[model samples]
Target: MNPFNKSTGRVVLGGAGWSRQIVTDPTSKPVLQTILHALSLGIRAFDTSPYYDPSEILLGAAFSDPALTSKYPRSDLLLLTKCGRITANDFDYSPAAIRASVRRSLDRFSTTYLDVVFTHDVEFVSREEALGAVKTLFEMRDEGYIKHVGISGYPPAVLADIAVEIRQKLGKPVDVVQTYCHMNIQNTTLQRSLGRFYGDAGVGIVLNASPICMGLLRKGGVPIGELGDFHPAPRGLREAAAKAADWVEGQGENMASLALRYAVGTFASVDEKGLGVTILGGGSIEEITENVETVKKMLKMEDNSVEALDLRDYSLFDEEAYKKDEPLFKGVRDILGEWIDYTWDSPDAAFLEEREKRKNQEK
Candidate 1:
């Protein structure tokens, strides 16, 4: 049976944002407490990557804590990590490297197997290399080191095409596919490709990550601290998003909350079978609690409220709040203007050229 086919909840706790805090101090009690808090609140799945430095190590430490193990057993949780892309400009897609990465992740997490492992940021490397890495993951899946295999990147079309190609060549569909910054208020490109992912690619699950577009949709503009010094969005798009954020804030509404509501509500409404998942990030217990509460409220508002509400017993339904924020959502979208649905280039030309230069020297 496909591991993704099991119920993992609609929202996954993203480890990237929270892990950034502990890179210097991996044993930070506050960060570990945040993880425990999320688990206590019923978040069963976690998304992490070795590329995020100490993210894997931090999460491993959290899971190993007696506080977590005593209450939530390994079987009750889902661990999702990635391989291939090592840093902003480094990647290794060789089968040997892929195998080593998975083994290393296992050792770091102190787990017998990972629930899912994605070929991290496939667009950064050549298609052939990405496919080779994915094939290696499948072999590891068979060996029980991984339970599922998939690919993740910026371009939804590229991800869909790769999923189709994998099915054609390997005779099995990818267990899951993750695409970030494409399903938020500004960009809904991922929604358009859902049919292809489900019907054409036969993907078992599709994870829509970065509902806030990696902090691009927030009031403070694009973040440029520990995560990175640059954002992939062009100047015009960034300007438009700034205007949108200002509009939302002027109306006394939080931009990030509105974006999260729109994303969670939209995805939850369309995904009747619950095969779709949204990955959200938070840096503190307050942020995680707020995000989870926002998700709960959105779930309550969904047409299929019963199933979504069943995940948590508490009721967060507030029709009045929803009604008040509905207009703000539309207003922000209008402010986005022509930038809506736009996708910026990933692994931009400069990086591609640099990669080619390195490859040529090897020959």
Candidate 2:
């Protein structure tokens, strides 16, 4: 761990290439204001990607902001980017594309070498494709153009497997692995391996896309993304979300308070070395600031390892993978009205049945 990482603790703010959907939208003004606001807090890490629409451009604007640069030294910060996906719906993992992407990111973000660059989207591609993409990232890392090398994939998928497999071939452990480990679903196999990878391999893991699914567990008929709406639902989907909402809403406090607490605390308590970083997103600077403070409070609470937030990623069917797996939705029972607790004490067969069905499909 470097001085910059230890000082910031284990949290990475919303720079994780997800800025396009939430931050740089038309309605939001003073776009750079959000970045300024986050920097005002103790946040020093920024993850970004050319994949975000005009996001690299917006970050360049923030980096050059006189007031922000004055308050925080430019060299004092860490800026991360990725390659492999550009625009909204495309996948290009060629080595040339990766090089072009990094160079373009430099031009856009107004930064020299990236602090970290991952093989952007590793889930859909095969291991061979991923290795090729990673080869480029490692090349940059070797040139000192990229300080570290990593990969980002969601769910249990290929990235998890590749992270472990690459160790033998690369002769060095991966420096970072960015994945979505949230308050909803548990890739138990992946989670168990992640701690070891971080410990034995000296790999740093970055968590993203939290609070979206968990945020819905608290607020009703509200969407947390850029311009989403929680609307009419099918019997199955509504049943799932509504059941979890029952337990989540009854507490009087929002699930965001509990869920975010669960994420950081869960990883920190059990893993001896602990989760290296978490990158969260929000609607405003206030939202970002609130997230940081909330995480600080949650880490102070109980650290239970069993807490799970699994999301179903049926974008064509629902709110994408961002939905389905939130921990807040665990209150779902069935037509029989049994409470489907995600905890250890639930014995509802209907709840068990539905949960099992989702797992079986992953096979």
Predictions: Cα RMSD each? 3.2, 11.0
Candidate 1 lDDT score at position 74: 93
Per the 3 Å backbone cut-off, how many clashing residue pairs does candidate 2 have? 15
Best by TM-score: 1
Model 2: residues with Cα > 4 Å off, grouped in runs = 1-4, 16-27, 87-89, 181-190, 199-202, 206-218, 221-239, 300-363
**Model 1 misplacement above 4 A:** 1-7, 19-29, 272-274, 301-324
lDDT score, candidate 2: 0.56
RMSD from true fold, candidate 1: 3.2
lDDT of 1 by residue, 248-324 (tens): 87888888888998887667556534545789888688989889877776655235444443344422344455566
**Model 1 steric clash pairs:** none
How far out, in Å, is residue 347 in model 1?
1.6
lDDT of 2 by residue, 144-172 (tens): 77888888755533555677677766766
Q: Considering summed lDDT, which 10 consecutive residues are worst modelled in model 1?
A: 307-316
Error of 1 at 363 (Å): 2.4
